[model samples]
Target: MSSTASTATSPLGSGAPPGTERRWLTLAVLSVSLLLVGLDTTVLNVALPTLVSELGASTSQLQWIVDSYLLMSGSLVLFCGALADRLGRKWVFMAGLALFTAASVAAAYAGSVTALVVARGAMGVGEALIMPATLAIIGHVFPQGAERTKAIGIWSAAVGVGTVIGPMVGGWLLSGFWWGSVFLINLPIGLAGLAAAAFLVPNSRAREARRLDWSGAMLSVAAVASVLWAVIEGPDRGWTSSAVLLSFAAGALLLGAFVTWQRRSAAPMLPLRIFRHRALAVGDVLILAGAFALIGTLFVVVQYLQFVLDYSAGQTGLRLGPAALALLVAGPLAGVLLPRVGLRTVAAAGLALLLASAAVLGTTSPGDGYGRVLTAMVLLGAGAGFVITSTSDAIVGSLPDRDLGVGSATNTASIQLGAATGVAVSGSLLSDHYRSALAADPHSSDLPPDLLSSAQESLGTALAVARHLPGEAGPTFADAARGAFVDGLGPAMTTGVGVTALGIVAALVFAPSRTASAPRDKDAS
Candidate 1:
């Protein structure tokens, strides 16, 4: 889609344009759609163990059930954002909601692990379209600065609210029903959202009338798909497997070609020019770093609750509430706090808090106190809330007005890609350490490989097992697993610390001066 297209106009120009009532209604409906998408993405996490038992899923398959959704959702943002602009934001957004509802119904009734994973992937595609388009609509609807800021706040709040409730809802459902109920829940909400959205949102289109960047979009999809495929499969197959090598090579080649083509094309899908603003660049990088740590933490923490604490899915969800409350407070507090201190100062403080929180998390032993874990959770949530809100504001504020949707894409894509990378890196680290530690132990001979894999996958879980195994063997395994996970956590947290430190430095040295206007064109990047 060309930059020439207008972002807002009636699909039928003569119709009454949307008013404040309609705008808020549209936001409400879109927010629900967002809530469903966000909830679906994370809710399945608490139900994974149950799903595995019921469906006879393998380690790789379980990973796919989570990862395929994330991978597709992350990869499709570039094209989807352009599609919203070219086709009509309202049209694309509603279509996504409809698709999502249908897919969720299919996911609920899935008979096998393969079917469930495929359904989740389809749901992810729906999610990719809905999110950026909704954001773009927010930008279009709330033209005034104060109103827009408030709108963004509401949008960000929806994320926190959705995240907090997702596990709790999934937990409650999984307790009485099957794991399928988590996906099943999306059906009614999606339908209501679809109905509400049709009446509320105004139609919008890109100003620049030009061809869609078909080549760029396809290349981008292939590039990201190939890379994600290799990264995901690498631990299962040996890293040097011929298929893995080919996937990696293809991903790199396609990605490089996409970048090259975008630079040369008259109407690029993902114009390289967006990277020019130092504030935007630094913000994008910092957003990725924060997401990396946060996601990696989530993956490990759930394991701790289920495996180490011996908590049921419902119990695990309930335990996460304090952290969620902390997150709820932090976004508003950070907005109040950020401008008072510079962005660099506030972000650095948050990252420092995160590093400290991770260290505290490493203190969990075979049967550690719950209070200590809860405190760590609060600190992590507070820090993450600050990081997410602050970085998001900086990225969007720094972008030129001409590319609002594209800017939104850059922000969302950075988040999705960052999350994808974090999961791969953190999961790989924990998996490798967990397996090696257990196999090296003298008593691991009787343990099945899958049992060992599950134990190796999380410290909390291993700790839980250690509490129950015959003849003190379980405790011994748990102790080994806890040690291995801590070892992995330290390095991952260290990487976060180092990256955040660099972001702080970059923000101070390279960010645009306060007096400067948002940059566009070649100078914009």
Candidate 2:
């Protein structure tokens, strides 16, 4: 639908209206929406094993369970963001909440993996709408100052809170109920967000309401989805496979076309000039690097806890509390310090700490004490908290008010891509190294080729296979597999160390010394 051009008399005027004090209340309501989106990202992780058993889901199907949501959300975020700017942020946000709520109900009642995947894709559409709107509303409500910084900080903290509680809540629910309980929990929160947002979030839109960039939006979605599809499929299909290579080639061409179209278009959805700003450019890089490390670590470590340490889902969730607590404290603290210290200093410090954590994690072994791992996890969390908050402040604070929706979408998309790349790279490395370790073992020579192939596929499969082996062979095979898995972690984490090291240099060289002023467009909110 075409948006009406906003005028001074329109409720869509850019300024915070007379009741500016209600901004905090608006923030609270917006955060509720954000929390639900963030929680869904991780909550289903702990239930994957259950899903596999109950639904008889294959490996590819399991991957789809997660990727469907990310692919849709990440690909369409830019388009949805522009929709918010044109139509109205409040209208888009409420529509998103209603869609998300309905999708959650469908997901909870899904009878098969195919149905669940469809529901997840629907949820992603809702999430794309909600994410950019929340950030844009915060930018409008807080204006430019310490208050804006703090509000962004709170938003960052809410994500951290969601990350921590997702597994714990999933575990608790799964203990007594079925796997669907996790998705069912989102229902009430979505309803609450819809109700509160109507009363709290003010209607606002770009004053000019430029024509929609339909071609650019389609190309952007195609480029992002193609690249992400390659990343998700690359490890399993072999990086050099024809399909993977073709996907990468398609993504590159589409991306080039997108940039060219944006430069030439009369009205662009994302202005190419924004990348010229040091803060926006560097902040995005930092956010991407932090997400790569954080998600990659969680991907491997959760398996280590469950398969290697023999911890149950509940135990693994509980063990992650220290890291969550550290993140909870560090997010707000980083925001408070951003204006006092420069972005360069704050971001550099965060990267340095993250590099240290990666180095420590690389040194872990199968027999290492829990205390050491916990310490490393906490350090990782603290470093991530600092980087995420500071980078978000830099990105949002640097953009013009009119660009807020698409700009926020850009930030969110970078995060989703970083996460996809991290898991794929780390998983591939772990698989390669573990198989190599097993092949070189003298004991592995006794196993049949088929059993060996099964063991090489995944740690879970190896453990399952070991249990059925003859007598002493079972324990011996289990020990060798666990040891090989630990050996693989070292190489996997080495990649993280390199990624974070690059982030440190980027922060020092490219990030602005101080937060830049918001853009000076006449209609800027």
Candidate 3:
């Protein structure tokens, strides 16, 4: 085949470019689909307490319910991106939308923690397919320049918007209906996106037919799953236990093997050469760190508001509005500034803000009230907005046209992996510290062994046990539980500060000083 024949075809049929109106409309449809994917990332966060009461979920189970979706999506996105490149972006996107909608129904009616977790994993599969396709389609539809940058900024903002809005939506739903309503709400949105996408979204795929790297795909998934399993289960199962140790060892081996295979494969799932792009490398790290801070903080704060401060789900959602608003505002603003200011300044500033946010949150005490937390949320939101928008633009813009599918997938995988890690690491630290504090408390010594064991499982369980106790003992035990939870939040926030500080340093040192020049389409060379 001629080199010219090996480039991506125009998304619009018959080589007629889509009109500006159609291009923006396509962006709208893609953004809404992306919104659903992003919404799922945090929608379940507010519903976690309800799940504890409704499904009798342990802390580990709760982490699993959230991380399972993240894990599957993060791990499989590359493979799905490859499929979309070969088969059709539109086809994979529609299929994913349909599957995600169906999985939402299954998740809504799930009767047990195990069932709900399974349903969530299924949803993750759908997300893996949808996330990359949307970005790749955007790459196909929009030319690389200011126009594409603006579109990508809007696309990036949809993620932040979805994530921030999730708690509010879930809170409103949980206020009137069962927890299942959180999942069920996706039905109308998903169905509408699916139908609109069929007509509005144009089809595109790689002109060159390359062999898919199945071996690399499997190794990547297994490695991630093993590492995440160890992280999530380590607190409950004992970090030094044979199973945890084995998982860590296996993950390391699988990761090394994956790297070796990719280097040797005829058609690697992820081309190692891409990381040579400084902006792309730095962008992925910054994006990952930003996501870790934002999502991890949300995981802990939502629980803190509800479990400690006695806020209802609706109230908790309302309180979180400042962060969402800040993010909504900052995202577009970052886009407008990127071409003028350069990525280095914008990205470093964003990470600096996140570090400051984490530092503030680390000092939080039960008596600090909502004011302190509100300040932290605003910083977190604005920081994440700048980081996600600027870095997403950097990552996507750095790639050659041929690499857009897998490149976008890798970009998004960084996000999901970071968010998943945030939940696992934050929850583990919280659980381990809470358990230790509870064990050390004098109030815990008076409880029965079985009750003590249950209390050690989670703050919610501890509070429940305290409620059933007699007289002053009940209130004292509850106070201890609340104190322990507050103590646990410190370590998680401290970790975030450390991570953000590192990201700030990296961004300042490595990120490019100027906006991307133009699309070179290196494949043409």
Candidate 4:
């Protein structure tokens, strides 16, 4: 039960000798898996319009396309992570990759919205398996502390690369091909990974006596999925509807039960005891908040670029180039800086930058130039980069030496949760405010009755139709829709500012300044 950080500084490896060509080959396989997952998260966004046009997906179906993936991926990751620990990392990861690849093919060929939704959900299940399995393997393979940090830094950089490149790749595919091409893109990547992994990666078996928390896992999934569903459906169902209220009630009750059950269960899916450490708790909270703000806004921004600014898919991809470049530069710098500045200082700087970036974004209106957009995007990338890299280090460092699987599970789950919640929260705000704004506008009369009904739908869906309107009515409709979209962005930014500000205060009040060295005597188990 030695402190993970202290022992982690030394070689605590579970695999082959460091610097072997085989080791890097193993990393390459895992990196591809990571790239696919990250790419899939934002990739389909540029293709959403194409999806709607080709498949005739309604507003609710469009939301489902996105939300289904997040819900399953986010909610099931902890269970999947633990399952890998009890099983084997490489096998589970390979399985996840295979399943994900197959699902992509299915999604690509899906004729109906329902089939795509189901395929995407299946893809999420695969992603849940891959993410934690990869992290756990990193813990196993890179024994030496500095090498592990470097390895994970590369992993982190890919995450940034994935975030940046997803849009570009999706856009490129969509411009020449179709919406389904985005899903098809993953097939080659997955096949290459499978080929590499079979030769390069060493398998690690789960220790015996690790208990499965089936009931807790079910409840956790039910709770998170229900909550997300409620938020996504609130517009269609009416915010005050009986079903929405019931979903909320059920989610809250189940989550509460899950927490209570964790306190009593001998084996918990998520160990609440981990949060007793200040560094781990604060780091996790900031990671969650940062993930939400970054992901949620990205969803909205692509719509803004395409529907409001009239950028083509390829053009939209190019517009976002600055954010990716900023992250590529910032990620390595974070790896070098985090250990020196210490977690608290590094995290605070990140949160402050995030607050400033989000605040600036709150001011973005129609006709705002690319220069202003790039300025805010850079800050957002840097801030999110710090939180993700340093905080992941901190979370992993907090675990005991033997429970790297559990540690990875915790970290992975937190991120997914943050991502899901970010989409849910901001998406809810975006749709609600957009609808309200359009409904209240005096210019509503100018739009055809059917078109006006469409405008009151989800912000992204509304924006798409406005951009595609018939005749001279198109320009005015686009203008009104862009105003509502901006109207939504301001509130979303305000929410981000408030959330990040709270994170800053939380770090000051709670995060520890001690070296990341894990304490041996304090290991609870």
Candidate 5:
């Protein structure tokens, strides 16, 4: 295609090009869809204890309930990105919205734990389709420049808003309704997104859409699923167990094969050549690190508030509100500064702040008041706002229009992978530490072995069993369990701090000092 043809505003089936007014309207619809996706990520964290109480779900089951959705979304996101480029972005997005809406209903009405898990997996597929398309569509509507950067910042903020709102909404719902109400809330939003998307969004695709590479897609999904399975199951099953070892080995082989196939394929789904760009590679890594810290912190801390500090879901959500407010305030400001200070400085500062927040949270004691923790959460939100917005701008700005779907998908996939790993790793460490703490507690020596075993299984179980025991012994046991749980947070959050600290170095070393310049669609090369 000629550079002029590439740059020119093309007619959308209607003979006229989209106007500026229409472009922003389209963004509004896309943002709504993004908000729903963000809400789903953390909504379930607040519902875990309820799930355990209501459904008799084990600790491993609870982790799966969270990880299953992430695993599917992360695995299929890139493939869906390629599919969007081949098909039309709007078509895939609408289909995904429909599927997600339906899955939400199924999840809300699920009869058993297994049923809920299946419903969550289906939701993941829908998210994979919706997540990448939103950003790719934004990239299409906004031409590369300050306008695009600002637009991306808004888009990034929409996602941040979703994550922050998830806990609040979930907590409020749980206070008055059943745990299933959290999933049900998505229905009305998804229906509205579908209607708005149909009229406002334009259909767009790559200039030379490549043939779908089925082999590469399958290999990628298998590799991601197997690896996530290993991570999710490793702590419970024992890392040295044959099942875990085999899963790791298989994931490695499949991933290697997927890479090799992409290298040799005539029409590749993922153009590996893109990684050569420092912005794309580094931006993706930073996103991964940010998500790891973000989700893992949510997973551990929600339990801390509920099980240890004895806060209700609503109280916990309200306590977290300041962090959301901080993120909302900082998100757009980061965009305004991008042109002046560049991505590296903004992103590095964000990572540093996140590392500091993690360290503060790590020192939290079971009896501590909410003040120090709330301060740490504010820092956490600020850091997330800067990193998420700046890195997103860098990733999207650096890509050509034709590679927008691929690039957007990769960024979204990195987030899902990090979320999955964060939950798995942090959950594993906490579980191990909690069990060890329970076994070592002097107060537990007189308790029956089976009772101690039940207590060691999970905080929810420990608390539940403590309620059945009579007298001072019950209170003492409960106190020890809460202490163990709080102690576990130290190592898990410390792990997050270590990961984010590395992201700080990466942003400084690999992210460019200036924003990447996108070639105008109307300009000739």
Candidate 6:
């Protein structure tokens, strides 16, 4: 169970260890893949307003544009991971990269909201294939211990780099080109990654062949899709609507079935017994919470800066620089500290920072300048960096050698599901609040019925309508819309505060005090 024993027994250990340079080069290539995945996560955020104007997308439709990719990627990753274990990691990864590149072109040229959403979902399929393989490869290339931890830290930082770069790049593209330009940017990056992967990346898989769990895969995909559908549609459909209620019911039942199937299956996609490791279980939960808060806040804040504060997309992306910078510094630092300190201490501190970030952001108002928001963004980024890096290490470190593929998939799935849910839940709260506030505003009384209906759809729609209104009425209506958006931002961020607080509690109660010296058995229970 020690690092020495793990390395000696590993399937990859049969040959001479890869040279230091080759290992690092392989990591760089894999990092590029992660960078692309991370970039897509937020690139669309700054483009949401543009999509509304160009495609006539409603609030729910915009959420779908974002969540569609996440839902598919999150749901299918487990299957892809198992397939990688059965087939070959390198082949699956290359195939995924090609598919993702093709999907990017489709997304870029999409003419309708539905087309874009579907294209994004296709991209997610490729993403599901790429993500787990990246991490699982790292597990094979680097032995367990400090080396592996450092590799993962750097690999994880690529995602942070991508997260920050996405908006800046997208904003710059939007300044001169059409909204589709954002998706187009991925074409060259994907191609370059494919080339690098072909030559530089090494192929590895589980030594033992396992049967694929088709039923479990189906149940998970349906459950997650149903839940996301309900959450995204609830605001517009009314929470009590039969469709929303039925979707939620179906999701719950499917989830229960999935658990039962996993428990009984001969070769399970995810071994339920792995959760017996306190560190692994708690780490997964914290990662989910961290992503939920981080992605959810970004979803709303980008809109707030552009709509309420009247910043251009480029300017808004620039303002987000502080968070990115903070994350860049915090991620590697967390990795260094994990061995010296302990998981509970590091994770709790990170969650506390997140809690503070959410509290500060929750107090933001339209009149407030960027200073308060800047402070919160920095905290959010740093908190996320520490939490994600440390927790990712914990998850990868706790798993036995054979579970690396599925375990890595589990980690990635938590992130995708968290991000998807964050967008759905936070967007829903924002829409509900925005609609309520706009309806109550005195400006609503003056608008004609048709115009009022359009305005109530979203802040972007309202502002578009205001542009055509006569003189002062135009300015007044726009101001009212901005105010409503700010009102919605408060509740969305407050929910983040609550989630982070719970994460803090969970970390303190369940996370291991120190990193284990050896990996736990997969069948620990």
Q: Pick the candidate with the highest lDDT.
A: 3
Candidate 6 per-residue lDDT, tens place, 253-342, comes to 999999999999999888887787677789889888888888888888888888878788888888888888888998899999999887
* Tens digit per residue, CA lDDT, model 2, 1-525: 112332333443444342245788988988878878877866776776677567866444556677677777777787788888889888998998899889999999999999999999899889888888888878866768888899999988787667656776777778778889999999888888888888888777776666888898789778877776676666567779999899999999999999999899888877778787678888989988887777667666777777788877777777777777888888999998999997998888887777777788789988885676687778877887898789889989998878888888777766666665666566667767887897787778899999988777666777778899999999899989989989998988898889989999999988888987786343323
For model 4, residues 242-299, the per-residue Cα lDDT tens digits are 9999999999999999999989999887777767656667777877777777777677
Stretches of candidate 5 off by over 4 Å are: 1-21, 520-525
The TM-score, computed over Cα atoms with residue i paired to residue i, of candidate 2 is 0.91
Regarding TM-score, does 2 or 5 come out ahead? Answer: 5
> Which parts of model 3 have CA positions greater than 4 angstroms off?
1-21, 518-525
Better of 2 and 5 by lDDT: 5
Query: Comparing candidate 4 with candidate 6, which one achieves the higher TM-score?
Result: 6
Per-prediction RMSD in angstroms? 5.0, 3.7, 3.0, 4.1, 3.0, 3.5
Give the winner by lDDT: 3 or 4: 3
lDDT of each: 0.69, 0.79, 0.87, 0.75, 0.85, 0.85
| Candidate 1 vs 4: which has more lDDT | 4
How many clashing pairs per prediction, in order? 16, 0, 0, 2, 2, 0
**Ten-residue segment with the worst summed lDDT in candidate 6?**
516-525
What tens digits encode model 3's per-residue C-alpha lDDT throughout 298-337?
8998999889988999999888888889999999999999
What lDDT would candidate 1 get against the real structure?
Answer: 0.69
Q: What is the lDDT of candidate 3?
A: 0.87
What lDDT tens digits, residue by residue, belong to model 1 across residues 113-146? 8898889889878877887788777766654344
Tell how far residue 493 is off in model 3, in angstroms.
1.1
For candidate 3, list the clashing residue pairs, or say none.
none
